[model samples]
Structures are given as structure tokens and as C-alpha cells.
Target: MKKKLSLLVLSLILLLSTSSSIFASPSGFTESELDTIFEKAGTPQELINQMDYYTKLFIVENSGEDFEFSSNSTSLYKFDSTLDTFIEVKETDIQPLGYIPSTDMSLSMYTFNVTVNGVAMKEIYSQFEWLNKPKDFPAGIGKDNLGIALPGGYEIQSGRYACAVQTKLEKNDAWGAASSSRCTNQSPVVNNLYGAVWEFSASQNYLNIYYKGTVKLTARTVSSNPVKRAVSRYSQARENALGNYGVSIGIGAASISYTPKSGSNDTMDADTNW
Candidate 1:
């Protein structure tokens, strides 16, 4: 009887241990792993507070997907010695917008079209050029043109429509300088881009809807630090048939004006997304 009771107690202990191991976390992360992540993210409320605007937007856009963390050969997290913890690395792509400039770094341009609610929204023209002793050329500049088009016969609900354009210069994935422009019905001109004219459809159906603007970034020397220029264009329509809808496109162009040292600029690749 004593031997039988001892066997029963051992089996129960093993069963309980197995159950606890199986129910550690929904993401299949062990308790110790979860503790490390939480420690890096700080308190629960702190982690929530640290979420930025873009992060929230991403969550809303991908609400149907389950969020999980996995470590492997292609894991996004990397150990940081300064913080003594792991940090997630976000990789951005500029392929969706259009062609990326080659290493030769000549002039390149692409046009991207956006459609919302079965209606054509606008066209974005992104261009980058290397100024070889052009009159008063500092280093390089980013030029963008936005052309707005609204299909006829389709009645657009009266709502606010806004467009924003941004250009950023970065070196080694670090931001250097930026310029932006925004236009709306209430404010026809926010920032002027090379004296470009902005036009809107003369129809009452669409209260405030038009996309016309130009954005230019100040040039920076790239003799030592090879940099990349990223141009982003975004348009938003609020209270439309599909509720609030927004479309954004971006492109990145590499600058090779100055010859780079062997293997020194290997990590200067450009990756941009909007």
C-alpha cells in the first residue's frame, strides 16, 4: 500500500510539471523569455506608452494577424550591449513605390498611382538627380510632384482631403536632414516646392480634395559619409464611403557622388517605406 501511494504521488507531480510547461505563454515563449522581453520593454503601461503613431497604424492595418516573437537565423531582434538587452530591427522596403537607383547613381524617376474606394486618387512623381557643378548646387536635392485627379460622374462625399510629402536624408541608417510639405482645402499652400502650382476640381461634391505640391530637400555633402535620400507621399480621405482611408508611397535613391572606400560603405544601403 505504501509503495502504491508513492507511485501515485510521483505521477501527479510529473503531470503537473508537464501541464505548467505547456501553458507558459500564448506565444509559446517560456516564462524566463517573457521576463527578459518585459524587462527590456519596461512596465506594461510603459510599453503601451512607448508605442508611436506609426506602430499603432501598423497594428490597425494588420489587426487580423496574431503578434508573436520567434528567434531563428532571420530573427529581427539583435542583442545590444549598450542596453544589455535585445532590440527589434525594423526593415523597410522601397520596392513597392518603384525602381531603386543602381550603384552608378545616375538620375532616376518613377511614377506611382494611388486609388481609393474604386476611385483614382492621384499620381506621385519621385525624382533624384546628381548635380555635377550645377549653378548653386550644394550636394543633392530630392524633388517630388503630386498630380491630383478625380474621376468624373462619381460623386465624392463632402469631406476633408489632405496630402503630405516628405524627403529625408540618411547616412548609415541614421537620419540627417528632412523637409516636408502639406496641402489641404483650408490651406491651399503649406510649403511651396519650386513655384509649383496646385489645382483643385471646381465641384461641390468634393468639399476639400486635391493633391498638388512639390517638396525639395536641402543638399548635404556626401564626400565621406555616403547617404541616401528617401521621398514619401501620403494622401488621406476621411469620412468617405469606406470610412477613413489613406495611401502612402515612398522611394529611396543612393548617392554615389564621391567614391567610397573599399568596404567602408558596405552598410550604406537605402531602405525606405511609407
Candidate 2:
């Protein structure tokens, strides 16, 4: 009877996985890999043995919150614990926003509060996640974009961002994230990519939300007039007195969409896809 109930619940989750929403966890891997995973058959104990084997193969943890295990690794299998059988998280996770300055490639700490219906919510992260990053990063490149060569004078380049959520809690509750269909701005300014997302829960009179994170990209822009500038003669004279060069800030054009972590903004869904 318990096995039957587990199967029923697992089926429901699998079905819901297809629905367009932030909760869907996609299986991360190639089609062939997925087929290989689907070919496995088993009970919960067998699935755990398989998962343990694959986890060892990848040299990664067998189970970790915020870390979705949808893809197969031969050692790890995606199973419906309720059903005691294999299942898949079609899409899971979220993308976060913000940029890292090129000067110091360090991860910035960003914190925001969540109020659903009207009350604030709390969460926790893992210590290993925080400790794994570098203390100080490269001079001009962030961890995300590091080792990727770029042309000179190219101060900014756009790319997708996938961040890990670091929470310190017994339950290991965290913001699962994915990139929105819409492109957002991000900077590889830190040693390792880390960001947050919000998840949601509701009651008769209350709605609770948590932050999940994923990777997406912001568009790149070029200067319209890179070498030409107009500055005031008087300003130039003042600069000469201070032994400074003429200064004129040139603005470029680009577009970026970001998600706010609190209030009504915390509620995100498939429509939020870019």
C-alpha cells in the first residue's frame, strides 16, 4: 500500500514536471544519457545503490539540497522515493541577476527579504558551498569568465550565469534557480558562480516563497563613438590645474531583465521565461 501511494505521488510530480513553472527540474545531460538513465529499473533500495555508484563515478555528493539529481551518472539515478522507482525533473532551478566588477573578481553578497501575502520567510545554505570559492579572484577576470580569452578594449562580454545557492541549515532549504527565457545581466566577478532565487508556497491566507537561482545572459553593447568626445574647455582647464586628463563618460546601449527577490516580484512562473 505504501509503495502504491509512493508511486502515485511520484507520478503526480513527474506529470507536473511538464507544466511550465519554476518548480520543474530539468534532467541535465544529453539525450543519450537520459535514455541510458530511463533504461534502469528498480525498487528504492536498488535505485539508491545505483545512485551511490554514479555519485562515486562523478566524485560528487550522492544527495544534496538545491542540487537537483535528474541526470543519470550510472552511479546516481533519478528516482521517485515515493514511488520507489525512477523519475525525472524535466527542468529545475533558476537564473539570478547582477554584475561583478572587473577590478576585483570577488563574489558580492546580496541579501533580500521575502514577504508573501504579508509575512517574511527564512532559509539556510551549506558551508561547503561557501568554503569552496576562492578568497580573492583574478585581477580582471571573474571565475565564470576566467580562462576565456577576449579581445583588448573589450571590457564587458555577456554570457549565461549558473550560480549555486549556499545555505546553512539542517534541512538545507535553498533557492533553486534556472535562467529565464529572457536574457539577464550577470558578471563572472566571483571565484565560483553563486546566486539566489525564490520559491513559493501558499495557505488560505498566506503565501510563502523561496529564492531559486539559474544562469541566463545579458546582451552586449558597443560604444557608438569610441575615440571621439566633447568636453568643456573650462573643465579641461580645471583638470590641467590638477594634472588630470579630460574626462567624459561615454554610455553604451544594451538591454537586461532582472528578477527582484521580494514581495510580489518573488512570484515567478513560465511566463517569466525570456
Candidate 3:
């Protein structure tokens, strides 16, 4: 009986040890498997070239006072020629391939700043409603104002407001939008003015490669009475005719835009390879 008990305990210990060894690495892949991926990639640069990533930005009104932007998530994918579709690469798998995670590389360090008519405005960070909900937005379509909630009490005056995102990377590298949307409405009614007007610019880097592409969304308000009417007419006419606005951000096949009503479901990719 004593021998049988000892053998059972030894078997349990061995099983636990095996399980730990199998899952010890952050990635579930074993060292041998990672080596195989590296071998298949051919070169380190090619391994990076095989991967593509994108970030999502959602701009929504906060408690009818100010706008809130959420960029808490990013998705990475690797092109599989055989599958003919991009397969998602887990966050844990990024470092194993000798590349920094997208979140760490850009998203985590992003800084958001607001501006009114070219003058910087203050940004207040607090617990927002959308933060609790899922961050999913449609990839490339437009929707109505059903879920949108804009601020109120500014119907008398029109202004151009913007919320821009920026990130400082290694080796004095910085990337962000040059400008944002120039059209916005102060009334609580969702306006037909929906679009993204920003250019993402990046400085050249010789030492290390960083993400050179960017996607940004911002809110704007036009205050002058005459300009407001003109904007309203232009926006309505465009919305009624085209139904959507497509703005190209001229970076490695990346383009982003908004819709006629909701302006929430837009996404773009920033390729890491040169």
C-alpha cells in the first residue's frame, strides 16, 4: 500500500512538471516550433514583412459635454499564402519572431490632445461609458446616428474642434496626424458632417524600424453662422449623394474615413515593413 501511494504521488508530480514545461513560455509554442517559424521566414526582415497590423480609434461624445477616444486595442496578422487570408498572430507570438508587440510599439504610448480652431484645448481623463463596453467597430462601412451621442448647449456658436493622437517612439522618432476634421456641429442632433481629415507623417529612421503608418479620428465644430450654413449644405449634399466619405492617409496602403451618420466604423493598417 505504501509503495502504491508513493508511485501515485510521483506520477502526479511528473504530470505537473510536464504541463509546466509545455506552457512555460509566454507563447504556447515550444522553442523548436519557434525556430521552425524563423527558418520559414528566411530572414528577420522577411519575418517582419510577413506580418501586418492595424489599430482602431473610436470617437464618441462623453456625457454630452466633451468627446472621448478609445484606442485600447490593436490586432496583428500574418499573411498565409496557402490560406489566402490573414491569420491573427497572438500578442505573445510577436516577440518570439523578434519584433516588438504593436501595443508596446505604438498604442501604449499614444498621447491624445484636443484643439479648437488650431488652439490646443484641455483633455480630461476619466472613466467613460464606452470604456466598459466592447471596443468593436465595423471595419469599412457606414451606419446611421442610432448609437451616436453628441454634446449639447453649443448650438449658438460653431467651432472647429479636433482630438489628435500621437506617439513617441525610440531614437527620437515621432508619428501623428498633421490635422483633423474641419467640420462639426454643436447641436445635439447628429450632423451629416462625418469624415477624417488628417495626414500621418513619420521621420526616417536608420537604426531601428518603427511603424510609419497611422490612423486618426477627430471631432470639429464650425461656429460662424454663415460658415455653419455653408458647411451644413455641403455636408448634407455630400451625404445625400455619396453616402460616405473616403479619406486616404497616404501610408503604405492605409486609408481611413467616416460615414454619413455614425462615423464610428473605420479602420486602417500601418505596415511595419519598408
lDDT of 1 by residue, 85-174 (tens): 334444552322222223222221122223345443222222222212111111111111222221122122222222232222222121
Residue 58, candidate 2: Cα error in Å is 17
List, residue by residue over 180-222, the lDDT tens digit for candidate 2. Answer: 2211233323211112221111122211222222221111213
Output the TM-score of candidate 3. 0.22
* C-alpha-based local distance difference test score of model 2: 0.22
Error of 2 at 232 (Å): 32
Provide the global lDDT of candidate 3 against the true structure.
Answer: 0.27
| Candidate 3 wrong stretches, greater than 4 Å | 1-72, 94-199, 202-274
After superposing candidate 2, which stretches have Cα over 4 Å from the reference?
Answer: 1-27, 30-152, 158-171, 177-208, 212-274
Best by TM-score: 3
Candidate 1: misplaced stretches above 4 Å? 1-144, 157-159, 171-274
Q: Find the number of clashing residue pairs for candidate 3.
A: 7
Q: Model 3, 1-274: lDDT tens per residue?
A: 9999999999999999996665234324443444344344232444223322111121212112132222222344433448753355665664333222344332211113355456533222111111111112221111111111112211211232332222223434423222222112212222223322322222223113322322222333334321211000001111223334332221111112233342222221221111
Cα error of candidate 1 at position 71, Å: 33
Please give the lDDT score at residue 211 for candidate 1: 20
